[model samples]
Target: MKELDCLFVYPGAPAGKKNLLPIMPAGLLAMAAYLERNSVSAAIISLPSALDGEFDLPGIIRERRVKLVCIPAHWHRQAGGALRLAEQLKRAVPGVRIALGGYTASRFAAEILKEHPAVDFVVRGDGELPLLKLLGSLGTGGRSLGRVPNLAWRGKEGVTLNRTSYAAGSATLTGLGLAGLRFVLNRRLTPRRGICFEDGMFTYVQARGCADNCSACGGGRDAQRRMCGRRGVALKSPASVVRDFAELAAMGIKEIQLPLNPLPSDAYYIALLKLLMKKKLRPVLKIELCGLPSGKLLKWLGRALGPESKITIFAGSGSEKIRRLNRGRFYTNAGLMAALRLASRLGVKAWTAFTTGLPFETRRDFLATAALVRRMRREFKIGRSGVYVFSLEPGSPLFEDPEKYGVTLRRRTLKDFLAQRGKYDMGYSTACFTEREIVRNLKFLEKTAR
Candidate 1:
């Protein structure tokens, strides 16, 4: 009966393990932060916490009395549960509008509209600016829903599909008055005295479109144009990044993750690290590199964070051939080891991630990956290393040209991925690797890695 504007729902950790991943929902938080600046009162419900019995999601919905409930269908694994939540919300408050967005919803908006009746609108692409416009249009009347870019909604005749659109760049984040990533959960925001790193793990979108050509990745340049409607990578100014980092660090955030492909040019990263050092930002900086880490890059990071700041660099497999095929890296194990050694000397803990099941990978390839993990653990003091199964995501390069990559497309539908959920990692075998091979590889890795 009442309208509280908008409610952003994080569908929560997918089926698999019950442990919460130590990362903030950055995309949703950015939208919520933007909406707040535009003067809209939005409530957020983190379903993972709710599912864990940390909070009651339905009660929050009733209390907020939101006009629109926005569920994120970003990851395919979240589709089924997100839609399920939308259905429940609709039943609780039938008049309320239920909308879905993010990668999964964006790619399958039309199909979701045709199949699911409870979902009202599908917000595609980036929801930061489009969300503001959608809420504004909703305030006046729901008639202008079609005018909003990157939206799929039902019309009188049938489902209306709008051309996917891209709004905002990395520079858009610089204009935010205050970073409001804290409201990712339903609990009322209590002002913390300072930055509590444990309470402040957040994903920092350093760059927009990835320049790397990782054939299996969805965030690659080709996938960006096809999926998110962006061209080349758009980066924030080095100064802007420093400002945001310093602000987050001052607030007491102990860890901050930057998602970047090779992290701009060495000069850009060098400058960022230097400025961060000057500002005395001591948070544990986690950098996800699309390729191998360079010696200079490692040195600058070491200097920037100082000796006390813990550094974690996420890299791919040790097998150069497999790394090249899976991640498009041109470096060898020697180079990676050298960089890791340098990072170790600088007190940087390298976080290596190995994907067990990938296109063109065999039992030998899996063993190679495991061997590299062990070598790193033996030679360099690795902070953590784990093997993850490669999920054939819809918009990825392998998904597009599986034949070229020597892989088969088994899971192609939204329901297919929904059926996977947590199992997408290693619980289930994919077309590339059989269940027996996966189990053998896992056992070998478990024995070797330990």
Candidate 2:
């Protein structure tokens, strides 16, 4: 058997709305592409699929002759499992270099490396390129590790750190060579089982990072700039945006998901939609656009994509008070009303999404969101739009300081959330919010949706 050069391990997290379908982690996919581009053979193994824990990872590595093991740690939820997996990989392949990279890797680098001695190198920030360089350097006779940026390692003396540099500028979506990625994952990354959409599965990004200053959001303003060392939203060039969709269509990927934060400009979105139409991509081209559309924006989208176009609007709250707290300035009830009104008139399938139990939220606040959702459904006949309860996301400000908003961190840690065995999975848990208020508000929202 041919020796496997590298084994890229994609750590899993609990999935589903009620615990629903597996979301392909784009970061791991992107890194896979980068490694393959540099002539490194990489295989992605998703731990979530090993639910019964039947997969013999050590035996597999031995069979495949694996060399390097790279695992990405996401927030607190996957950190423990990912770190454990890293230790296992180290034990399985003593010569194999184990590395950790991801959002949490960058945010809590010092602490993670100190705690996880199994991790030989910590790839901080956007790790694709640095990881590629590191792998290439290792492939040859041992070379000085001085060139690779965002690398943290411990030596004979002590720990050594390198300069911070990203795989590429976070702004350029075109920099992400999807055409290249699709080729590598063609064999390894089979279509995700039980996704929301069937026969169409592609995830593309129109923009990287966010501009919102929400103190709770991990990628909000200051944090984003500090993390990426840039200001404002960085979008993929319009042509690159369109090309990605077109490529997916060519590959028989019918539904393309664009998870752009803060959304992209009207012109960029319109241009990309027009390009997709030119290629004749079919029903349900999904995108997590940053807020409710504006009246003018809705009109433009409707005209450009036709009534059959489906778009999910992520409006976290209906109450102005709650919106103010989340720093969700993109939409107000008035703005949302206008957007929904236009969508209804144009015959577009628009879904209004809201989350409950925000920091500083009260019973009145919950009622406000429920009432607003009910009104939207009634007024616009937007039956498909509904409210989603809040879950604690570590990178968000809500997790950073839960107490400030009159909530207590009941779950305590990631382990507690993981050990849960009931209908309510981590996705729906309000670890910080009181259970009574959360249950009451969620019931109200569900009733209103019905």
Candidate 3:
């Protein structure tokens, strides 16, 4: 048995998405690395696998003997589960300090602190420095409570709050250091039945924050700066990102997923691809494009990753109208199809996401979207497609001003969300679609995909 100070927990949200296979806790991985870099011994736990009876977490906690447990609540979908996991851990290891961090947790810190007694601390913004300080001050009997920044703690004078920074400048990818992906490769993390790729795939990040303003997404540019205190999108060097991938390849992780924002510069992307081409990375890389790509970029991607390397595009919605409303202002269905057409020609796989009953979505538009999805699958010959029900996110423009978009926003209160069956689930709770319509569309999507 080893004595440890902290253990990071990845609270999985299986019910939120139709397919949770690709939902890796990449942020927790990065944060773990950050902690390790600060000379703290840490390990990440999976709440999903634990719930599914894959491992004995209570036993593991006793064996490891950690003083503090940090469960990251980045996605709102995973927040409730994360809180529940924290409560369970507290009960298992009595007196073990519990904390939560990441986007969702930061956005809703006040209410979470008021509600969850098991959560001793909540990291409000940039987590690296604050977490490092918190760990250093742990076991000191409240001697250093005020020193830790961006922390909400259960103080003697009620919940004591500290200065929290929202700027990406305060905490950047470069500052957090390496992607601690290998930590998740443990057999304990594997479910009885998981995706085959889960056994080998590794997730990495190139940037923090996004510049686009997708109406329904809370991580949009405006939302980030206004609510999250994240200013500009902080990017890491291509050399740094490529170096990490190369290291992963050497470590026997051939399939690397770079879940980055659309790279800030095309030249940077070209350079990254060129560097990747030079390395001995036999990688099946998955990248989420912010928008449709140009022919040149597609050619660059083809040259960088040969036919052996599988590519998966994260394009959501094949309908132009839905794209404008939810995805971004610039990208169109035609542009997306063009990229897929190029991808098909280059022998690469792509994924186009779909949302039924969006704001201003007529039955005609839904039909058009369905038709386009079918066309992408059969005609353009893209790899795969997915469909989902549209629900307003807490931080998105659509959530703030539902009337403007012809959509009614539900789940405004923390109580509403906590009470919901699938709190952060992207179920059809929008004014645009009835619950029946959502269920029917879900069935239709399943049928089409089959």
Candidate 4:
């Protein structure tokens, strides 16, 4: 076999830890594709898939002669798994270079490099260009590491952070081949399936970065600015997105999820919907709405996507006051119910989600959320509805300025996050709610779910 220049590994949570689902981000595949397009040999392996008896990871690494390995600690949940994998790979392969990237990694780049000796570098932000430059330097013995933008590396002096100079734009995102799954080495493994795949659905990214600055979302606008130097949402062209959808449909993907609202303006979403309509590709479409869509937009969605298409509304809290505080875009329960009514009339199933442990939520506030969920179940074409306890995200507003939100941070550093390996842990607390209170409320709210 020929030598591989780079291999991207997606880490799952450590054993007994219930963090995120075992799926890798769609963007990671795009990064791999970007490297391949640039004449670099790259492939992806899901750590969960490897551990599921799909293949021997170390043997494959040896066979491919992979020179560099990249792992993403995109979610704080993956912190333990990513670092553990890096350390294990170091012991198993002896000489392979390891790098970590993504939101969580970028936020704690210095700490990771300072503590984890196995991680040779942390590609802090928008990784494509930085990773390309890092690989180039590595091929020449890593003497030019300082020139790589958006990178953190240990030097003779100490840890060095290069300028975060590369923020990907629409053109860059359009060319990434985001739906390219052929590069995943263990794509066939069933036990390691992502949440979407488990539900017989696949996710397609139409944009990078988010416009909203939701208090709990690490991928929100301010978080993007802080982590990736991204100024605004970078959308894939409508034509590009339509083409990717067609490709996914061709690959027998029966349902596709556009994970977020994909917005800077609704015109962008409308244009993509029109393009998909023109293509007449009728894969079951699912979208997450950061805010309630207009009735016209709902009607258009019904026309464009046909039946079995769905939309999820993230009503973070049921109490209008609490919801307004936590969300960037505010909508009243009356407005949400109206939107749900419109969606149901248009034959589009709507799913609503709520979080129980937001900053100012009280027991009464949680009951309001529960009441909303019960009302949604009884009065709407709700495909699913549930309330979950919130986990603090590393780059979110609440995480960055906990004092401002009246939140007390529990896991503030890389080591602090990595210590929760054996069980589920919510990462923060508020004056009104203890972690125990949060869990109790979550259970109570869930009982109201259908």
Candidate 5:
């Protein structure tokens, strides 16, 4: 371990439609950028996002001589695969360290430590600092094993919980050299099936996190704490923000996806848009929009964005009460209608999302949602962009306060879900809703997609 050289590997996602969802592990890129900034040599291999199939993992690790392995926990599907890789790497190199992070790792540290004994440690929060610190400790052969918040280590006595504080929003996004890291991965994965999207489009952090306390969103307060151990949304400086996007635009990435809700105000967003336009680039814009845009605002955007701008709104729930329950500042149905009317008038293809079976929702609410969807389709002629229904994510407010919403919480072992992932025809059912209702509503929603 003379060289502070490390390899960051992102665990793969559940394989499904290949073209529609080409995976690129943003975390791995972030980790690589962090390690590189510390004057350490780091390389990232995003297995899920790899163009090469799973069969190529062994060769890649061998060639890279990977010392460290970092992966997030939601990528539970890759556990078996990652474990096998860890075993091989240790045998080949004799002292490889395996680290895990992300939502899954933070929550299920015990389960992962038990299941994958090969894993050296599990990182709890924003991983850049923890990873660097852990590597520094490993490099020096120091074994104090003091508390490191957001880390769980395996030792003689099962697992040791270190109070090493989980850090987030700690580093400057621009200072990380994201552009350089992207270039590195791109070169390594060139001419492969689907590498990084090198088109005139880029997705940067308009802000690090979200402000709206939507119960189901990952960025919500309780959810963020549970997931990343952070309380508030960590936003980047505006200069950094504009600089990153301008760099991406210069790289020929025209289209950009901004944040979901509680985004920058009209002035901030408009200014950013004008700056991009001043660069003489026209790109498709996707945003997490909510509530209704005023006629004046719509007209301004329509005139400013001209023909190339497209906005995507994620309403999250059609049931206003459910929306309110989920901490969505409920836009009156009138407000939603007004937005739809604006999109229709401006000839802008607006996309909206909603969910069903929100904890305490009734049949009337479901029908009301259905009716709204149908009316919007007929009135605005907005084509189908409806998300079928709601899911009770593990860290969401709904998961935390299910009882308050008249829903009983049911926990399923990880093994049960993993067993069902590969079977396409046997679609899995989560405990958020009864199997009967999910099927029925999915059928009802099919009318809109048709």
Candidate 6:
């Protein structure tokens, strides 16, 4: 076999620890496909999955003569593992270059490059173009590193950050190969939550950027603007989305998840559903709703996906006042109940998730969330529901300005985030609740929810 030009490594928890969630970012697969299309040999390896199988990482790198290794620090949870793996790789394969990317990495690119000597580069936001350019430069001895847009590299004096100018558009999204199943199928990769490997579930991203500015979200509209220079949502055409679905179905993907709600208008989803109906592609569809969906949209979704389809709603808080304070799309409990009722009537399974430790949530507010969960259980046949603690995300409004939201930051720097390795720490405490109180409330909510 020919030597790989670059290898993409998806980091998990630190050594001697198990990751709570072990799913790789879907964007990494798409970026790998893009590299392959551009005549760059690239493959993805989930580090934890490989380690679990006792796969020889150093031996494989040496055998393959891999030139570059890319790791994604997209989620803050992966920070510790990513840096640990990079150091291990640097020790094992001394000549190989390491690069990190994703939302978390982009936000702290300069800091990562300055502090982590093992990481040779950090590709900031929308890595397809910047990564391709970086690879080309590396092939030519990295003399042109300064020219790569949205990149931060370790220079002789210090870390050098290039221009933040590459936000992927609809055309780029449409042309690139989004599914890279060939590389992942052989590995012992774990399935995402509520999905089994036998189910053949895959997440398909139909757009770049976000329309909402949820305060706690790292991928909100404001975060995108600051990190990726994205001014608005960039969406793939409905026809293009239909083509991707057909391709996935042809490859035996039984379930497809549109993880982000279509932005700008409901027309995008409606058009896509119409095309899917026309093509007679009936894969189990999962749509994640940022806010409550209208009855008309729910009806269209049911008609398009039939009874097996599902929708996951992120209802941050049950109390409308706390939700409003959180600064996401404002929708009342009445609105959410109405949507749930409509979904139940249409035979569409709905999974609603609430957060227990929001910024302004007091004991009463949390109890309200717990009560709402109980209410949901009594009134509706929800597929699944849970209340999770809200972790402070990097690049979020709360993280950037903790005082504004009455939040006290526990993990502010990259090193601080790396310390939370095998734990589910909230990483911040609100004015109303300490970390202990938050955990206690979470336990109460968990028991009540069940």
Predicted structure with the largest lDDT when compared to the true one:
4
lDDT of each residue in 345-366, candidate 2, tens digit only: 8766778777777667766777
Evaluate residue 333 in candidate 5 and report its C-alpha lDDT on the 0 to 100 scale. 74
Model 3 per-residue lDDT tens digits across residues 1-450: 767667876656534543333354566676677788778877776655544565676777778787778887776666777788888878877777889887677777777888898898988766766877888888677679788878888877887777666344524575555556555524554343221235355556677678787767777787776555677777777777787777666666667666645443467567788877777454777766666667776787777775655444445555576666666645666677777778778766666666675666667777776777677678854336777665546677777677777776556755555555542245334555666676677678657855
Worst 10 residues of 1 by lDDT: 188-197
| lDDT tens digits by residue: candidate 1, 46-126 | 654443466555666677667678888776656776788888778877777888987778777888998888999898777
- What lDDT does candidate 5 reach at residue 438? 60
Clashing pairs in 1: 195-251, 195-252, 197-254
Candidate 2's TM-score: 0.82
User: Candidate 3: what lDDT?
Assistant: 0.67
Candidate 5 per-residue lDDT over residues 261-347, each given as its tens digit:
454245556666566556654556665565455566566566556566667666655777767676555667778777767776786
Model 1 spans > 4 angstroms off: 1-3, 14-24, 50-65, 182-185, 188-200, 260-264, 306-315, 381-385, 424-432
lDDT of 4: 0.81
Greater-TM-score candidate between 1 and 3: 1
Error of 3 at 309 (Å): 3.8
Clashing pairs in 2: 16-19, 16-20, 216-396, 216-397
* Deviation from truth (RMSD, Å), model 5: 4.0
The local distance difference test score of model 6 is 0.80
TM-score of 6: 0.92
243-283, model 6: which lDDT tens digit per residue? 88787777667688787673736677778888888999877
For residue 19, what is the lDDT in candidate 6?
70
- Looking at model 4, residue 324 earns an lDDT score of 87
Better candidate number, 3 or 6, judged by TM-score: 6
Model 6, stretches more than 4 Å misplaced?
Answer: 51-55, 183-200, 262-264, 381-384, 421-423
User: Would you estimate the TM-scores of all the predictions?
Assistant: 0.86, 0.82, 0.84, 0.94, 0.83, 0.92
- The positional error of residue 228 in candidate 4, measured at the CA in angstroms, is 1.8
